[model samples]
Target chain A: MIPTPDLSHLKASDYETVYEPAEDTFILLDALESDSDTLKQLRPRLCLEIGSGSGCVSTFLGSILGSSEALFLCTDINPHACSCSVATGLQNKIPLNLVNASLADPLLWRLQNAVDIIIFNPPYVPTVADEAWTAQADRGIGGAWAGGKDGMEITNVFLPHVSALLAPGGHFYLVAVTQNNIVAMQQRMKDIYGLESQVVLRRRAGGEHLSVIRFSKTLAVKTAVFHSNTSNNEVL
Target chain B: MVRLITHNLLACHAKGCTSNNFPLQFKDVQIVVRESEFNPDFLRGFIPKIEWPALVSSSRELGDTSLSDQLPEMLDDAFLKTLHRVLFEIHVEEGVMICPNCSHHYPISNGIPNMASSVTLLIRGLPYLASSWLNMKLANDLKIS
Candidate 1:
């Protein structure tokens, strides 16, 4: 007996469609909750999501956090997302602060290490120009898949920011496809910042399985490693 | 935990501040390497939202410069492993994010960016107070009007 979600469609820059979530959004939200619970061993206190296609993810998150004494902020680079989030919040009886902003902007947001969890379902498959690139699918320019060439460009931009929003011990869940060069991406994540991350879930379809990645950040605040010689990369 | 995402959102716009005061640059950065299993799918999906050159150069600046100039020709495990580490595993625990043009420095204390300097704080808070004061002034103006 799920409550009806407020539905609305927020349009994106071009060729990108923002669907205000109704039903399908529930399953995705369920997936995120299920995955997030596994990581924290309980429902978290704070949750933030980006690229929320419709208000579904936003709705789900709001409800989950609202049930707890928590806060939820749903942001999308698309204008449509901003509107949909508002409506969805009202429909679901959950409170949400909607932000219509892209990932490229410097986050002036005040939430610092306050988020206990972060979730994203990014566009993974590269658009071949011939492939159907919808507003829903084309999360970015060079291709519908946000990260260019290797589907990590966007993730790279996002990873460090994830740390800022998370608390001392926080979790991040990201979903993607196998087409993005995985090996190199993993290595880059490892060699660059020394944060640990792994894929916790996978589903196969037509030789492709949707993959879910769950990552956690350690206390990276500078004072944690003041004695280290080079402050730039302690433990390097 | 200053996220590159957060970094992209900040600009040093103190009073009369202008110039390329954006994309707060990283400095005195610290990188940590922790290994987590790889997920090719996640990496693939995340490609759409990235600032490619910023990521490439930032990684290089932080000293995890293994990512080649181009995407890997193949999805070989060895190659993906490296990419995975660089893209996800590394962490910047401490540093200052400085504005390239305005020389505005956003300090990253404890992996969290102090997006505010005292100047920014006073500047931002003052306006709210000013507005409230202005409203009071407006009430007085009403008497005159």
Candidate 2:
């Protein structure tokens, strides 16, 4: 197993302004690690991580795809997190390009149907919409977890853009909790965006039942189910 | 700092400025090129995704005239190496990226771009002491130490 990126460069004071790597961050890393072979097979050219706090996840991805020509682009609302991401990338010898912007705004049109891999471990904590908006507006550590109204407000804002952002055969990995109604999210993505999804990993951490769902564009749901059944029958 | 891969994806997001916002113009740039390990296979796969004209012009703006104005039909090893250098090595450490249509200036200093400068307010109205106390406790609980 590839070890986690060295984040020793980040001091405690850095965490004061940035969202420190926690359970959510670890699960995202684990999901990536588990899918490393598949990801490498995808031969991704551009990998984008929204809400890349402390640069841990991106750096870990950098480690997996190591010194390749693949561009590891990261965005964070918190400027401090962007700075930390740069520092972490430097420390780990991973060349990470960080844009301190909210949820891929400036990147939309240009990046439309271009990004090979997109990952978002957004603010999935349940909170009032006003508080989440305030945190988002603040662009501080508060923005890390002040997810509004069922923890889907921020995630919801970014969802519609996913279908637009993904390249052909591109994959998107999102971190969510039970409160976010995972089934509804999957159904919504299927109905609206035609992005088929399946739960990749799940773990109960403290109060949050965290799950990482992986979505792909234009994947026919019935075909996947039929294919799985055929393979199972073949094994039998 | 802006890299070609980033510049390739950036467009002006200033309100009410819509069309032709792509390929933001670089101005008064101080570029530092840091050598990175070249991976030919990766670059070979990535070439198709590039906005060739934008990259060529942006690299030219950064004072690296290594890449041709057009994407070469044939991508050789030497050419891929140059493409890799232009895309990954050159960093716009100190500069302003002016929006093509809106004229919004995104500044880069100390190797990090201040893209969120428009929203400059941190969580407000709380006493510094109380906020720090809360942040510290939260950080510790999150095992940020």
Candidate 3:
């Protein structure tokens, strides 16, 4: 069991501005740890994490990879989060490149089909649409949650860019709640982008049913089909 | 903060600022070279994915000329070491990244780049917010009547 990245450098004041790692973050870590072998086999060169609130997730990924080979790029709307992320990376001996931008707005064209791994733990709380917009505009701790209209207003905007950004064999892991209509989302990604998905890990945290869904190109999984089919022929 | 590896992936995203947006021009930059663990295998595997010309030019912009103008046919340790220094060792502690196309400046201070166009976006969103608030008020008034 790889220990969680040490965030001893951060203070209570830091949590006021940045998100403190919680159940959702832990579940994402568990999912990645479970898939560590596959990830290491991929030998990813570039990994991006959108909304790296406390920088815990990306730092954890660096630990899992256990090498400095891959470039870990993290983005957040909050400037404070960006600073905290950089500090966390330094604390954990992970080299993280931080961009204080909303989503992947500045990276899309240059990184087209080149990102090997993409992780996003978006704001998945059901709030009024305006609240989400305001949170995003404010670019503060509220932006970490306050997802508008079934907690998908922010996630929906980012979904269309996933296929465009992922490398041929790239994997995108997303955190979503039951209210986000996970089934429909999976179907939409498969239908629109030709990406296949699997529910990697799920847990009931408080009143929220949080799950991590891993999406990859349909063609990229052909090699793994034989192994997967041994357990469930329909998976292919 | 900026590194050549991250800089190699940045392009301008200002509204309608598309062509020639990449390889953001650095201005008034302060650079620091911090030693990092070097792995030759990682550099070798990553060479194919790099935009050679951009990396070379960006390195030159920051006053480093270790890399040749073009990618070398050889994959020797000496070359990989140079590539590692250019890609990972050098860090931009402070700078303004100017978009070649739009001339929008993204400032990097204390090792974090502020790339959000929040002020303009919020200004643009105000009218929509006001209209929605008005509609809600009108609906509530009708219910009262």
Predicted candidate 2 versus true structure: per-residue lDDT over A1-236, tens digit per residue:
98888989999999999999999999999999999998888888889999898999999998898756488999998888998999999899887899988777777766767788999999889875456657877778989998766887678778877877788788999999999999999998888778889999999999889999999975322111111111111100
Q: Which stretches of candidate 3 lie over 4 Å from their true place?
A: A219-236, B120-135
Q: What would the per-residue lDDT of candidate 3 be over residues A96-134, giving only the tens digit for each residue?
A: 899999888788767777788999999999986567768
**C-alpha displacement of B113 in model 1, angstroms?**
22
**Tens-digit per-residue lDDT, A83-165, candidate 1:** 55555665666655444344312332334555667777665555422221222233333222433334444454465555555
Ranking by TM-score: 3, 2, 1
TM-score of 3: 0.92
**Between prediction 1 and prediction 2, which has the larger lDDT?**
2
Model 3 Cα lDDT, one tens digit per residue, B1-145: 5889888888888776767888899999999999888989888877876888989988999999999988999999998899999999899989999998889999999878888877643543454466668878999999999
What TM-scores do the predictions have?
0.49, 0.87, 0.92
Please identify model 2 stretches exceeding 4 Å from their true place. Answer: A219-236, B117-145
Q: For model 2, report DockQ.
A: 0.27
Order the candidates by DockQ, highest first.
Answer: 3, 2, 1
* Best model per lDDT: 3
Off by over 4 Å in 1: A1-16, A19-30, A36-45, A104-109, A128-147, A205-208, A219-236, B1-145
Compute the lDDT for candidate 3. Answer: 0.86
